[model samples]
Target: MDRSSGGRDRILRPVIRQFDLKDLPAIVEIDREVGGGYSPELFMTFHEYHPQTMLVAEAAGGVVGIVIGFKHTPLEGRIFWLAVKPAHQGRGIGRSLLSAILRIFSRLGAVSATLEVRIGNRRAQSLYASMGFVVDNVIPSYYSDGEAALIMRKIL
Candidate 1:
């Protein structure tokens, strides 16, 4: 369901809004569902570091996806921690979240946006590529599991 449209199928309706402390559990669930669980410490770290730019997508009475991001003043760029629940994959949620983020970056006058994705996450790579991001480099051992990360960037 599209919250913007007030449709009836809202059973898995999509809503996009700023992050709140109350939304942490849903965020954590999405993180874990995506095989990228985040600790309370890390979750707090995310909120403390970037409150204004973060967004959550709620569907079926739970948080189905999340995008935690913020602008880096020195570099005038934005980076994010984005994930969606496995069951909710293939929907336009990720794109909506990314679009929201880019709007925030544009508002901040960021010249570019950057993010890192595990090399094996082709779906994510495809999403970024479709959104106009280019592969910038590979960062070795970027994950605790020793997975390398594909660094991508979008020049606004």
Candidate 2:
């Protein structure tokens, strides 16, 4: 998606595509930069079991964003993680990745999609809300750091 604000200064259009094994390093780096702290092994596991739901956003010839999700049950999909390189954030890459994953989930026959967001992350909450996800519940001490999480869901 092209996130340029106006004419005469076009931004690089991000191309959303399936995750490639070669994108592992870049994806890990983006997650680290975004303070996600997710292990590379987690991504590899998702790739192994749910390759269709793992996607990356490429811009300027580099991987700038990624989303990992899966249809955990016949009627539900779960979004495990999403991150955009700090330098590439606020330009729609994260949103594009999210939209792509949600579409994949719908195509995979999910009736609903769900995700968890840190309570303190209002930005993420807002984005998810804008994408039709509503807060379904809250999990106390959900994170290793003792932070609570908001469970959000959307009907696919």
As a TM-score, model 1 comes out at 0.84
Model 2: per-residue Cα lDDT over 19-96, one tens digit each = 999999999999889889889899999999999999999998899999999888999999999998888767677789
Q: Rate the local accuracy (lDDT) of all candidates.
A: 0.80, 0.90
Instruction: State how far residue 60 of model 2 sits from its true place (Å).
Output: 1.4
Off by over 4 Å in 2: 1-12
Please, what is the TM-score per model? Answer: 0.84, 0.92
How accurate locally is residue 50 in candidate 1, as Cα lDDT from 0 to 100? 77
Q: Give per-model CA RMSD.
A: 4.8, 3.0
